[model samples]
Target: MRQSSLTGGAIMFTGYLLFFIIMRALGLLEVVELRAINFIFLIAGVYTAISLEKKHLGWGFTYFQGLGAGIEATVLGVMPFAVFIFVYLSWIDPEFMVYIREHEPLGHYITPFMAAFVIVIEGCASGFISAYTIMQYVKAHTAHPHE
Candidate 1:
């Protein structure tokens, strides 16, 4: 489980990083339109991890196990990205931070720490919801005979 989670997390992190770089290179990083689209990778990562767990467990996989795996993968995967965001905002491009502060819908300035916190919180929430939703299908298909 640990191995799969770590591997899946790495995969997720890589995918996100790649997309971020691409978006930045294309000068679309600050475009709010692309933000939601990036979430597809996040969902893919969690789903991939849970699917791998299911494969490993074969016929005995359970909903809770899938949920746990998804959560673990999401946390591990998003941590690196969160750190990167902090560093990027703090050093690489403080102007982006200023832009965000100035145009934020909430009308609140976000520090680097706040940005990281929001990322983690959002990732965890997405992970939890995705895990629960995905596990419903797994649970239905893998239910035991006695149940």
Candidate 2:
């Protein structure tokens, strides 16, 4: 909704795309375990957005503001990445889809849309959690308006 959140989301999106491309280039895209590392990028991006918003608001920063910025950044960052994944699996390389399907619990039920949808859900939850946790430290250091 705000510039800081948008910028943070952009950073997260860029990192997600770049990392995926790098993994694909290295032929390690299939290494299921390595995907966990993407969470770090997500956390970093959310932190950046919330921190920026805090600075912008100065002593006016509030819990809700941080939460919104974090969630907005996460959604903005993840939506495009999910689309990219959907496109890649659906058109660029159906084999990857097959690979993912085979590795998933309900292998037969998995689809490109499902995969992308999962990312969206994960991103939103992660964003909320990340924001809440980060706000603990930030709120502690910040001078509350009521104070």
Per-model TM-score on C-alpha atoms: 0.89, 0.94
Query: Mind sharing the TM-score for model 1?
Result: 0.89
- Reference-based lDDT, each prediction: 0.82, 0.89
Worst ten-residue run, lDDT, model 2? 138-147
* Candidate 1 off by > 4 Å: 143-147
TM-score of 2: 0.94
- Residue 95 lDDT (model 2): 96
| Candidate with best TM-score | 2
Cα distance off (Å), candidate 2, residue 108: 1.1
Model 1 lDDT, full chain set: 0.82
Q: Per-residue lDDT for 1-147 in model 1, tens only? A: 466677768877888789888988998877877767647777787788888898898767777888888889889888998999899989998888888888888636589889988988988788778778877877777756566
Cα distance off (Å), candidate 2, residue 117: 0.5
Error of 1 at 8 (Å): 2.3
Worst 10 residues of 1 by lDDT: 138-147
